[model samples]
Target: MKTNTEVVTAAVVGLSGWDALVERYSRLVWSVPRSFRLSHTDAADVYQCTWLSLAEHLHRLRDPEALAAWLVRTATRQSINVLRLRGREVPPDRWEPESTLPTPEDVAIGSDRARRLWAALTTLNERCQRLLRIAAHSPELSYAQVADALGMKVGSVGSTRSRCLAALRVKLEASR
Candidate 1:
Protein backbone atom coordinates (compact mmCIF):
# COMPACT_ATOMS: atom_id res chain seq x y z
CA MET A 1 0.00 0.00 0.00
CA LYS A 2 1.22 3.48 -0.78
CA THR A 3 1.98 5.60 2.24
CA ASN A 4 -0.13 8.71 2.97
CA THR A 5 2.81 10.79 1.83
CA GLU A 6 2.82 9.07 -1.53
CA VAL A 7 -0.92 9.46 -1.90
CA VAL A 8 -0.75 13.14 -0.98
CA THR A 9 2.05 13.71 -3.45
CA ALA A 10 -0.03 12.09 -6.14
CA ALA A 11 -2.98 14.24 -5.11
CA VAL A 12 -1.09 17.49 -5.64
CA VAL A 13 -0.46 16.58 -9.25
CA GLY A 14 -3.97 15.68 -10.40
CA LEU A 15 -7.71 15.51 -9.66
CA SER A 16 -7.47 11.80 -8.82
CA GLY A 17 -4.85 12.49 -6.17
CA TRP A 18 -7.03 15.13 -4.52
CA ASP A 19 -10.04 12.80 -4.53
CA ALA A 20 -7.97 10.02 -3.03
CA LEU A 21 -6.77 12.29 -0.23
CA VAL A 22 -10.34 13.48 0.48
CA GLU A 23 -11.46 9.83 0.67
CA ARG A 24 -8.63 8.92 3.03
CA TYR A 25 -8.72 11.92 5.38
CA SER A 26 -12.39 12.93 5.37
CA ARG A 27 -13.17 10.77 8.40
CA LEU A 28 -10.17 12.11 10.27
CA VAL A 29 -11.23 15.66 9.46
CA TRP A 30 -14.75 15.00 10.71
CA SER A 31 -13.71 13.13 13.85
CA VAL A 32 -11.63 15.80 15.59
CA PRO A 33 -14.48 18.26 16.09
CA ARG A 34 -16.78 15.47 17.17
CA SER A 35 -14.21 14.45 19.76
CA PHE A 36 -14.70 17.90 21.27
CA ARG A 37 -18.44 17.20 21.54
CA LEU A 38 -19.35 19.87 19.02
CA SER A 39 -22.92 19.96 17.76
CA HIS A 40 -23.34 18.04 14.52
CA THR A 41 -23.82 21.26 12.56
CA ASP A 42 -20.70 22.82 14.08
CA ALA A 43 -18.70 19.69 13.39
CA ALA A 44 -19.83 19.72 9.77
CA ASP A 45 -18.74 23.33 9.46
CA VAL A 46 -15.35 22.54 10.96
CA TYR A 47 -14.93 19.58 8.64
CA GLN A 48 -15.68 21.69 5.59
CA CYS A 49 -13.39 24.48 6.76
CA THR A 50 -10.55 22.08 7.48
CA TRP A 51 -10.73 20.60 4.00
CA LEU A 52 -10.98 24.05 2.42
CA SER A 53 -7.90 25.15 4.36
CA LEU A 54 -6.11 22.00 3.30
CA ALA A 55 -6.99 22.59 -0.32
CA GLU A 56 -5.56 26.11 -0.21
CA HIS A 57 -2.28 24.97 1.35
CA LEU A 58 -1.73 21.53 -0.13
CA HIS A 59 1.06 22.69 -2.38
CA ARG A 60 3.00 24.11 0.57
CA LEU A 61 2.95 20.97 2.72
CA ARG A 62 6.57 20.15 3.48
CA ASP A 63 5.85 16.50 4.23
CA PRO A 64 2.83 14.68 2.86
CA GLU A 65 3.10 11.93 5.51
CA ALA A 66 2.11 14.53 8.10
CA LEU A 67 -1.24 14.95 6.38
CA ALA A 68 -3.17 13.16 9.07
CA ALA A 69 -1.63 15.22 11.81
CA TRP A 70 -2.24 18.35 9.78
CA LEU A 71 -5.89 17.51 9.33
CA VAL A 72 -6.34 16.79 13.04
CA ARG A 73 -4.65 20.00 14.06
CA THR A 74 -6.65 21.94 11.53
CA ALA A 75 -9.89 20.34 12.65
CA THR A 76 -9.16 21.04 16.29
CA ARG A 77 -8.39 24.65 15.58
CA GLN A 78 -11.46 25.02 13.46
CA SER A 79 -13.61 23.44 16.14
CA ILE A 80 -12.31 25.83 18.76
CA ASN A 81 -12.80 28.74 16.41
CA VAL A 82 -16.37 27.70 15.81
CA LEU A 83 -17.01 27.53 19.54
CA ARG A 84 -15.49 30.95 20.02
CA LEU A 85 -17.62 32.42 17.27
CA ARG A 86 -20.71 31.29 19.14
CA GLY A 87 -19.34 32.83 22.38
CA ARG A 88 -19.08 29.40 23.94
CA GLU A 89 -16.45 29.14 26.58
CA VAL A 90 -14.50 25.92 26.53
CA PRO A 91 -12.57 25.70 29.74
CA PRO A 92 -8.92 26.33 29.08
CA ASP A 93 -7.96 23.09 30.80
CA ARG A 94 -10.40 21.14 28.60
CA TRP A 95 -8.59 22.19 25.44
CA GLU A 96 -6.10 19.90 23.78
CA PRO A 97 -3.02 21.54 22.35
CA GLU A 98 -1.99 20.94 18.76
CA SER A 99 0.93 19.00 20.16
CA THR A 100 -0.16 15.50 21.16
CA LEU A 101 1.72 15.33 24.45
CA PRO A 102 -0.44 14.96 27.55
CA THR A 103 -0.43 17.76 30.09
CA PRO A 104 1.06 17.06 33.53
CA GLU A 105 -2.37 16.82 35.14
CA ASP A 106 -3.48 14.53 32.33
CA VAL A 107 -0.43 12.35 32.90
CA ALA A 108 -1.19 12.09 36.60
CA ILE A 109 -4.85 11.21 36.00
CA GLY A 110 -3.93 8.75 33.29
CA SER A 111 -1.31 7.11 35.48
CA ASP A 112 -3.81 6.61 38.30
CA ARG A 113 -6.33 5.18 35.86
CA ALA A 114 -3.77 2.87 34.31
CA ARG A 115 -2.70 1.62 37.76
CA ARG A 116 -6.33 0.91 38.65
CA LEU A 117 -6.99 -0.82 35.34
CA TRP A 118 -3.91 -3.01 35.70
CA ALA A 119 -4.88 -3.91 39.23
CA ALA A 120 -8.36 -4.81 38.03
CA LEU A 121 -6.90 -6.94 35.23
CA THR A 122 -4.68 -8.72 37.72
CA THR A 123 -7.78 -9.77 39.64
CA LEU A 124 -9.10 -11.58 36.57
CA ASN A 125 -7.90 -15.05 35.64
CA GLU A 126 -5.16 -15.09 33.01
CA ARG A 127 -7.57 -16.00 30.22
CA CYS A 128 -9.93 -13.11 30.85
CA GLN A 129 -7.07 -10.69 31.10
CA ARG A 130 -5.52 -11.99 27.89
CA LEU A 131 -8.78 -11.86 25.97
CA LEU A 132 -9.73 -8.37 27.18
CA ARG A 133 -6.29 -6.94 26.63
CA ILE A 134 -6.05 -8.30 23.07
CA ALA A 135 -9.57 -7.27 22.12
CA ALA A 136 -9.37 -3.79 23.69
CA HIS A 137 -6.06 -2.78 22.19
CA SER A 138 -6.17 -4.55 18.85
CA PRO A 139 -9.19 -3.44 16.83
CA GLU A 140 -7.82 -5.28 13.83
CA LEU A 141 -8.35 -8.63 15.55
CA SER A 142 -11.44 -10.34 14.11
CA TYR A 143 -13.75 -12.51 16.20
CA ALA A 144 -12.45 -15.59 14.38
CA GLN A 145 -8.88 -14.50 15.03
CA VAL A 146 -9.58 -13.93 18.71
CA ALA A 147 -11.33 -17.30 18.98
CA ASP A 148 -8.42 -19.05 17.32
CA ALA A 149 -5.93 -17.25 19.51
CA LEU A 150 -7.80 -18.14 22.69
CA GLY A 151 -8.88 -21.61 21.61
CA MET A 152 -12.60 -20.83 21.83
CA LYS A 153 -15.59 -21.09 19.53
CA VAL A 154 -16.26 -17.93 17.52
CA GLY A 155 -19.90 -18.03 18.61
CA SER A 156 -18.78 -17.79 22.23
CA VAL A 157 -16.68 -14.64 21.82
CA GLY A 158 -19.47 -12.15 22.50
CA SER A 159 -20.77 -13.88 25.61
CA THR A 160 -17.25 -14.37 26.88
CA ARG A 161 -16.47 -10.72 26.32
CA SER A 162 -19.59 -9.64 28.17
CA ARG A 163 -18.78 -11.91 31.13
CA CYS A 164 -15.18 -10.77 31.24
CA LEU A 165 -16.23 -7.11 31.09
CA ALA A 166 -18.77 -7.61 33.86
CA ALA A 167 -16.06 -9.27 35.91
CA LEU A 168 -13.70 -6.39 35.28
CA ARG A 169 -16.37 -3.84 36.17
CA VAL A 170 -17.09 -5.65 39.39
CA LYS A 171 -13.41 -5.58 40.22
CA LEU A 172 -13.16 -1.86 39.46
CA GLU A 173 -16.16 -0.98 41.60
CA ALA A 174 -14.84 -3.13 44.40
CA SER A 175 -11.51 -1.29 44.30
CA ARG A 176 -13.28 2.07 44.50
Candidate 2:
Protein backbone atom coordinates (compact mmCIF):
# COMPACT_ATOMS: atom_id res chain seq x y z
CA MET A 1 0.00 0.00 0.00
CA LYS A 2 3.06 2.28 0.15
CA THR A 3 3.47 5.04 -2.42
CA ASN A 4 6.72 5.39 -4.37
CA THR A 5 7.79 8.21 -2.09
CA GLU A 6 7.07 6.07 0.96
CA VAL A 7 9.09 3.19 -0.51
CA VAL A 8 11.99 5.49 -1.24
CA THR A 9 11.63 6.97 2.21
CA ALA A 10 11.80 3.53 3.71
CA ALA A 11 14.97 2.75 1.77
CA VAL A 12 16.53 5.87 3.27
CA VAL A 13 16.04 4.46 6.77
CA GLY A 14 19.14 2.28 6.27
CA LEU A 15 22.43 1.89 4.33
CA SER A 16 20.56 1.20 1.11
CA GLY A 17 19.18 4.70 1.55
CA TRP A 18 22.46 6.67 1.55
CA ASP A 19 21.93 8.17 -1.92
CA ALA A 20 18.53 9.33 -0.78
CA LEU A 21 20.11 10.48 2.47
CA VAL A 22 22.67 12.60 0.59
CA GLU A 23 19.96 14.00 -1.67
CA ARG A 24 17.66 14.93 1.20
CA TYR A 25 20.33 16.38 3.47
CA SER A 26 22.41 18.14 0.81
CA ARG A 27 20.46 21.36 1.13
CA LEU A 28 20.77 21.28 4.89
CA VAL A 29 24.49 20.86 4.41
CA TRP A 30 24.60 23.77 1.99
CA SER A 31 22.50 25.96 4.26
CA VAL A 32 24.92 25.71 7.15
CA PRO A 33 27.59 27.63 5.25
CA ARG A 34 24.98 29.83 3.62
CA SER A 35 23.58 31.04 6.93
CA PHE A 36 26.89 31.15 8.73
CA ARG A 37 28.99 34.31 8.73
CA LEU A 38 31.83 32.55 6.98
CA SER A 39 33.08 33.62 3.55
CA HIS A 40 31.80 31.77 0.45
CA THR A 41 35.00 29.78 -0.15
CA ASP A 42 35.09 28.96 3.52
CA ALA A 43 31.47 27.85 3.43
CA ALA A 44 32.16 25.51 0.51
CA ASP A 45 35.05 23.99 2.43
CA VAL A 46 32.83 23.57 5.46
CA TYR A 47 30.13 21.90 3.36
CA GLN A 48 32.59 19.42 1.92
CA CYS A 49 34.10 18.57 5.27
CA THR A 50 30.65 18.18 6.76
CA TRP A 51 29.77 15.52 4.17
CA LEU A 52 33.08 13.74 4.77
CA SER A 53 32.42 13.61 8.48
CA LEU A 54 28.87 12.47 7.85
CA ALA A 55 30.22 9.56 5.86
CA GLU A 56 32.34 8.56 8.82
CA HIS A 57 29.40 8.83 11.18
CA LEU A 58 26.96 6.96 8.92
CA HIS A 59 26.69 3.75 10.92
CA ARG A 60 26.63 5.65 14.20
CA LEU A 61 23.59 7.73 13.38
CA ARG A 62 21.37 6.31 16.13
CA ASP A 63 18.26 7.86 14.66
CA PRO A 64 17.84 8.17 10.93
CA GLU A 65 15.26 10.81 11.58
CA ALA A 66 18.01 12.91 13.11
CA LEU A 67 20.06 12.95 9.91
CA ALA A 68 19.28 16.56 9.06
CA ALA A 69 20.28 17.80 12.49
CA TRP A 70 23.44 15.71 12.41
CA LEU A 71 24.56 17.24 9.09
CA VAL A 72 24.02 20.79 10.37
CA ARG A 73 25.84 20.16 13.64
CA THR A 74 28.76 18.59 11.82
CA ALA A 75 28.91 21.47 9.33
CA THR A 76 28.93 24.02 12.15
CA ARG A 77 31.76 22.29 13.97
CA GLN A 78 33.75 21.98 10.75
CA SER A 79 33.21 25.67 9.98
CA ILE A 80 34.49 26.69 13.41
CA ASN A 81 37.56 24.55 12.96
CA VAL A 82 38.22 26.02 9.51
CA LEU A 83 37.82 29.54 10.82
CA ARG A 84 40.30 28.85 13.60
CA LEU A 85 42.77 27.37 11.14
CA ARG A 86 42.40 30.36 8.80
CA GLY A 87 43.27 32.81 11.57
CA ARG A 88 46.77 31.34 11.63
CA GLU A 89 47.34 30.88 7.92
CA VAL A 90 49.31 33.45 5.93
CA PRO A 91 47.16 35.58 3.68
CA PRO A 92 47.19 34.76 -0.01
CA ASP A 93 48.67 37.23 -2.48
CA ARG A 94 45.26 37.79 -4.00
CA TRP A 95 43.85 38.56 -0.59
CA GLU A 96 45.44 41.98 -0.64
CA PRO A 97 43.29 45.10 -0.54
CA GLU A 98 41.54 46.28 -3.69
CA SER A 99 43.38 49.41 -4.75
CA THR A 100 40.21 50.85 -6.26
CA LEU A 101 38.30 50.23 -3.06
CA PRO A 102 38.89 51.68 0.41
CA THR A 103 42.07 51.02 2.32
CA PRO A 104 42.42 47.81 4.36
CA GLU A 105 42.61 49.50 7.77
CA ASP A 106 39.60 51.59 6.84
CA VAL A 107 37.32 48.71 5.77
CA ALA A 108 38.79 45.40 6.85
CA ILE A 109 36.71 42.58 8.30
CA GLY A 110 35.37 43.22 11.83
CA SER A 111 36.54 46.84 11.54
CA ASP A 112 34.44 49.76 12.72
CA ARG A 113 33.75 50.56 9.07
CA ALA A 114 32.03 47.22 8.39
CA ARG A 115 30.19 47.30 11.72
CA ARG A 116 28.80 50.74 10.98
CA LEU A 117 27.74 49.58 7.53
CA TRP A 118 25.83 46.56 8.90
CA ALA A 119 24.26 48.69 11.63
CA ALA A 120 23.02 51.09 9.01
CA LEU A 121 21.51 48.20 7.09
CA THR A 122 19.45 47.35 10.15
CA THR A 123 17.85 50.78 9.93
CA LEU A 124 16.19 49.86 6.66
CA ASN A 125 12.46 48.99 6.69
CA GLU A 126 11.84 45.30 7.22
CA ARG A 127 11.21 44.44 3.58
CA CYS A 128 14.24 46.32 2.37
CA GLN A 129 16.40 44.68 5.02
CA ARG A 130 15.25 41.22 3.99
CA LEU A 131 15.74 42.00 0.31
CA LEU A 132 19.25 43.22 0.88
CA ARG A 133 20.06 40.31 3.17
CA ILE A 134 18.97 37.82 0.54
CA ALA A 135 20.85 39.71 -2.13
CA ALA A 136 23.97 39.71 -0.03
CA HIS A 137 23.80 35.98 0.69
CA SER A 138 25.91 34.92 -2.25
CA PRO A 139 28.99 36.49 -3.80
CA GLU A 140 27.15 36.83 -7.08
CA LEU A 141 24.00 38.65 -6.02
CA SER A 142 20.96 37.74 -8.12
CA TYR A 143 18.23 40.31 -7.86
CA ALA A 144 15.71 38.14 -9.72
CA GLN A 145 16.21 35.17 -7.46
CA VAL A 146 16.18 37.39 -4.40
CA ALA A 147 12.90 38.95 -5.44
CA ASP A 148 11.41 35.54 -6.11
CA ALA A 149 12.50 34.30 -2.73
CA LEU A 150 11.01 37.37 -1.03
CA GLY A 151 7.69 37.13 -2.89
CA MET A 152 8.22 40.41 -4.69
CA LYS A 153 7.52 41.20 -8.32
CA VAL A 154 10.72 40.46 -10.20
CA GLY A 155 10.35 43.61 -12.29
CA SER A 156 10.79 45.75 -9.20
CA VAL A 157 13.94 44.00 -8.02
CA GLY A 158 16.56 46.19 -9.66
CA SER A 159 15.13 49.50 -8.52
CA THR A 160 14.43 48.14 -5.07
CA ARG A 161 18.00 46.92 -4.61
CA SER A 162 19.37 50.21 -5.87
CA ARG A 163 17.21 52.12 -3.44
CA CYS A 164 18.11 49.80 -0.63
CA LEU A 165 21.85 50.23 -1.25
CA ALA A 166 21.42 53.97 -1.52
CA ALA A 167 19.53 54.04 1.75
CA LEU A 168 22.16 51.88 3.38
CA ARG A 169 24.89 54.22 2.16
CA VAL A 170 23.05 57.29 3.40
CA LYS A 171 22.59 55.71 6.78
CA LEU A 172 26.25 54.80 6.98
CA GLU A 173 27.36 58.32 6.10
CA ALA A 174 24.87 59.78 8.54
CA SER A 175 26.24 57.50 11.25
CA ARG A 176 29.73 58.66 10.35
RMSD of 1: 19.2
Model 2, residue 1: distance off in Å is 12
lDDT of 1 by residue, 1-176 (tens): 77887887887888888888988888888889999899999899999999899889998999888889999999999998987877866768889887878889999999998999999999899889989999889979999999999999999998999999999999998888
* Candidate 1 Cα misplacement greater than 4 A, ranges: 88-176
User: lDDT of model 1 at residue 127?
Assistant: 85
Worst 10 residues of 1 by lDDT: 83-92
Q: Name the lDDT value of residue 14 in candidate 1.
A: 89
So what's the TM-score on candidate 1?
A: 0.48
C-alpha lDDT of all candidate models, in order: 0.89, 0.76
User: Model 1, 77: alpha-carbon shift in Å?
Assistant: 0.5
